[model samples]
Target: MTDCLFCRIIAGELPSKQRHSSDLVIAIEDIAPQAPLHLLILPREHIGSAADLRDTPAHAALLARMHAVAAELANEAGYGDRGWRLVSNVGVEG
Candidate 1:
């Protein structure tokens, strides 16, 4: 976990310009955004990557909630109709 950058962010050891945070996750605007509107969403739990997910039922619901959160944010920013992309970084695929 010491090697995890997200863990450091959640711990406030690493400086991130955070946008929002809830009990489960934290949302931050990407420092070097790919799009005009880009956000980095991460969970508080230390899940290594997509391969780390074991398809647990709880994880399914959690992912759904995370997507919903992103959707809500996009809609609020008037980007829902403009369209957007949610990228979950999974190891080298990121």
Candidate 2:
């Protein structure tokens, strides 16, 4: 996982690090944003893929925190309750 792009970003080894990084997650604008408010909300901890996510309390908390950050971002962007989409890409196809 040392070679993972996200891991490097989280480790402060990459310049792509955004202003929204925290202990639990890093929220960056998508390099190729397809929407007006596109953002890539990634975990600071390196999880190999969505398939690698396990059903545990820690995992659940992390996931919840991710979504909460996203919602907060959306609301701050003036999209509160207006509807926004979150897309998750898993495995190779991502």
Number of the top TM-score candidate: 2
RMSD of each candidate?
1.5, 1.7
Q: Per-residue lDDT of 3-89 in model 1, one digit per residue for the tens? A: 898899889998998877887788888879889878888888888887787788878877877888899889988998989888777
After superposition of all CA atoms, the RMSD between model 1 and the true structure is: 1.5
Candidate 2 weakest lDDT stretch, 10 residues: 12-21
In the predicted model 1, the residue pairs found to clash are none
lDDT of 2: 0.84
TM-scores for all candidates: the values are 0.88, 0.89
